[model samples]
Target: MRIVIAGGHGQIALRLERLLAGRGDEVAGIIRKAEQGGDLREVGAEPVVLDLESASVEEVAERLRGADAAVFAAGAGPGSGVTRKDTVDKGAAVLFADAAVRAGVRRFVIVSSMGADPEHRGDEVFDVYLRAKGEADAYVRAQDALDWTILRPGALTDDPGTGLVRLEAHTGRGSVPRDDVAAVLAELVDTPATTGLTLELISGSTPVSVAVRSVAGN
Candidate 1:
């Protein structure tokens, strides 16, 4: 399989890239800086530098052309304020989906937040971030042309992955290792049966593959 991921330099994305390439899949990562290309290459993923915040739909679509799947893993990152949340989280996500539609990439995945809701009310920066993610998720869910699955993981930790997880529509609040999240994403990208599902992820007793298969079956 050929897979393209936005925010290729992100921690979870890097792990995912390594996993995909190790499995002999052709993987490409979209980054904002040329310097990040070497890191992607180190993990056996081709690097495509394209700023989704400013790139046109046609430009992104061109990059996505012939891709088997696309994953929206981009974000403004820590210390970013409200405006960037909207631009990177909401605007860029919508743009990537549009590009996917134009490129005819049916399978799409988004790394979202647990409480992401367009109706979520608050005033802090985290509040704005959730709203942005929620709005972006709403747009993707509305796209009839795409088979999209949104994975909303709980708090992220750097702990080693146990390869077990609780993936469901409402897994409640918990912490999950980035490794486990990436592992689940790897399975999700391959499970087209998971289409139209917005799943929550956290550490659990069930193995990653089993959890994914169970969700896909549902």
Candidate 2:
């Protein structure tokens, strides 16, 4: 399979590149900086430097040529303000979906936050971030042209691979290793049943491969 990963330099994105490439798939990573491209190349991914924050939908679609799927894993990261959170997270996500539609790629997997439900709007201190992610999720779900699956993982941690992951709709609050979440994303890419579903995943007692296979129903 040919896959395009946005935010190629991200920890989870790098891990995903390793997993997908190891499976002998054609993988490309879209990054916003040249440094990120070099890092992606080290992990066997063809990197394309394109800033999602300012690129047009057509421009992104042009970069997505020949991709079987695209995964939106981009974020504003630390030191970013509330404005950046909206632009990079929400705006970029919409751009990706639009690009996917134009490129005729039906499969898209987006890494979202656990509490980004549109119905949960409140005056929380992190309201900006929450609303940003929430809007992106709603846009993807409402689009009929794309086969999209939104994976909402909880507070991300840097723990080593635990293999086991819990997958379900609206799974309660919990944190999961970033590695495990990547495992889920990569597996769901190859699992068609995961399409159009919003899954909330966290660590469980099973291995990552096992959990993915269970979700794959094979």
Best by lDDT: 1
lDDT of 1 by residue, 1-218 (tens): 99999999999999999999999999999999999999999999999999998999999999999999999999999999999999999999999999999999999999998999998899899999999999999999999999999999999999999999999999999999999999999999999999999999989999999999999994
The sequence of per-residue lDDT tens digits that candidate 2 reaches over residues 1-218 is 99999888899999999889989999998988887678888889999989999999999999887999999999888678878888988899999999999999999999989888656566643677778888999999988988898989988999887887788786698889888988888888988777778888887787766766666565
Best by TM-score: 1
True-structure RMSD, every candidate: 0.7, 1.6
Task: For each candidate in the order shown, give its overall lDDT on alpha carbons.
Answer: 0.96, 0.86
Candidate 2 off by > 4 Å: 122-125, 213-218
**Candidate 1 RMSD to the real structure:** 0.7
Per-candidate TM-score against the hidden true structure: 0.99, 0.94
- Each prediction's number of clashing residue pairs: 0, 4
